[model samples]
Target: MFETVLKCTKCGKEYSLASGIYKCEKCGAPLDVQYDYDSIRDLIEDNDSWFREPPRVWKYWMFYPVSNLRKIVSLNEGGTRLYRMKNLEKKLGFGKLYVKNEGENPTGAFKDRGSSVEITKALEFHAKKVVVASTGNMAASVSAYGSKAGLEVTIVVPEGTPIGKLVQAVVYGAKIKIHGSTYDESLAESERMAREEGYYLTGNYHYRVEGQKSTGFEIFDQLRFDSPDWIVVPIGAGTHLRAIWKAAKEFYELGLIEKLPKIAGAQIEGYDAIVRAWKERKPITPIKEKKPTVASAIAVKAPVDGENVIKAIDESEGYLGAVTNEETMEAGMMLGKEGLFVEPSSATALALAKTMREEGIIDKDESVVIVATGHGLKDIKTWESFIKL
Candidate 1:
């Protein structure tokens, strides 16, 4: 088993693995799972035993935070393919372009990566029930994983949450509560309910982040342990970007990767707090107004971990940009022509890449990878409204 500890991202305070803490008590910052890389290095021994059998994220269990292998609640999440976009590469004049398709996950979204580990940790904590507040994709992922783990699942979402997402959560036997006007309000209520009822809040949990780190691992391994020049991802709560950043640092410390990729984030124009902060050169401030967007999955007004998102972007020597709803939809349609049916939110990566290339921010010789975080099937209504099917 890999040795691990908990560390606060903000204050750098470390805690033993036995602690049942989610956030840092001293500064209220989110906690991260710190692993003993030296021990893992000895276990790996420059071997590729992990590639012998299964094509799942658990193959990299040595890097995950869960101590007990038996408690892992997995649906064979991860192992998503990186599709080399020859057409886009030629058209955009980039050196190479690949789309990391995360839509292939169990719940048809990348959130499954985080939910699987978070649910496993919930069971390890002996939680009777697990709770989460999400706009869409995450709620469905957590509900499905929690149900499979035989734990009661509760999801709090805004009334405007996509019907497809809610249907998944409900069909998976989760208790769904529609609350507040926006995602931020619902998330606040969910946190309150978790504290009041003593339920494990898996949303934004450190283990969830650890689970997401597997994506970065897969990307590195798929590229033959060579880091890409840049990874562009769509950001809502910023967990994915932060998780990838953490994984890059961990791999570098383990001597597995020689370099780190610059991480860029794309957001919808009205709900782009992180981008606004980057442009203004100020601290991340939560967006107070919620706007309507075709990408309902990323219509988060107030991202819980906005500060860390800004930090990750800056540390990666990257910039954040916002795309209009029309641009996001156009990007999704473009990807669909390539047989990659992705939601508008997922298409934001492509949208931002197009913007950056047009603005000369990204050079022609740099290889870029865009993370498609969810399936278009989950947002069929949005797609149907615009597409002539």
Candidate 2:
């Protein structure tokens, strides 16, 4: 209820909350849900009970734009574990290292966090059907959530999407459509369906960004409201990194945290548009050709939130880089040794972190948290090829 308006990230245009618009009409850019921060601050100050609530997405309801808490379509997502990688720390020669394991969420990926909010909003708008495009993770997450909410879910996936992920969506009763060879093509088809068929579009939009911010909130909470020196995340559409940074700034402004953490984004080499843009100081350009990689989940050729992600990194004085498939596999093995099994995309965070530490871009003594975005089992076929039984 504290949400006041939807503001354009590019043109500074504003729309009422009831307008039901997700993008800027004037500039064709994404819109963010703006809230009454003073009211939120006062509410938090007056009530301390919410802090004692179980650490889940709904626990931070005040930060979300949902008008009805009871109607929330949740799979008990969020509050994933923040683990200290003591063994890796010693081996890698780092001062402090931790992994925010998002793999533990329902449906075994961080996409569940976004789907929880998106589905709830879908029902609030009286939507009977929802559509989403994904390389893998989001489709499964949204399918599960829509099933729970009794909404018809249509999933559009690119060819070569991991079978493990598609099976999850199929089991959840989603109508599957394999659209094109690349994720961008699948997204175009989904968008067209949303426009023509009146289906509620779900993906890396503003509402999902609101939900995904909980990853950062939980990290800060687990750290007892303290900010880490760096929080590394793998970027696909670039939404997760931007969401984390937005959460950090919100917490800092609300006096919940004293300092902001530097945001680091990792991408597979061929899908490194945002990283290239950051290094070259140029606008993000789409990768025209698709290259094969084990990290299919994060293999986005044209990141939807690339511009905003760059702004977040620049604002936080962070680093962005890409790593090879071999390096990612090694990183995945390293995480497995640490008692964590993550997909190649998730392991990219660790690969980038190690590279940064060795290059002296990241100091050895700084506390670091790598946001492992998905479970290794989500892409069992890819794991089978690189990791022998």
Off by over 4 Å in 2: 158-164
- Cα lDDT of candidate 2 equals 0.90
lDDT of 2 by residue, 210-286 (tens): 99999999999889889999999999989999899999999999999999999999999898998998999988889
Residue-by-residue lDDT tens digits, candidate 1, 28-123: 888888777888887777677654544468877887877699878999899999999988888878889999999999999999998888888888
Cα RMSD, each candidate:
1.8, 1.4
Error of 1 at 152 (Å): 0.7
10 residues in a row with least lDDT, candidate 1: 46-55
Give the best candidate by TM-score: 2
Clashing pairs in 2: none
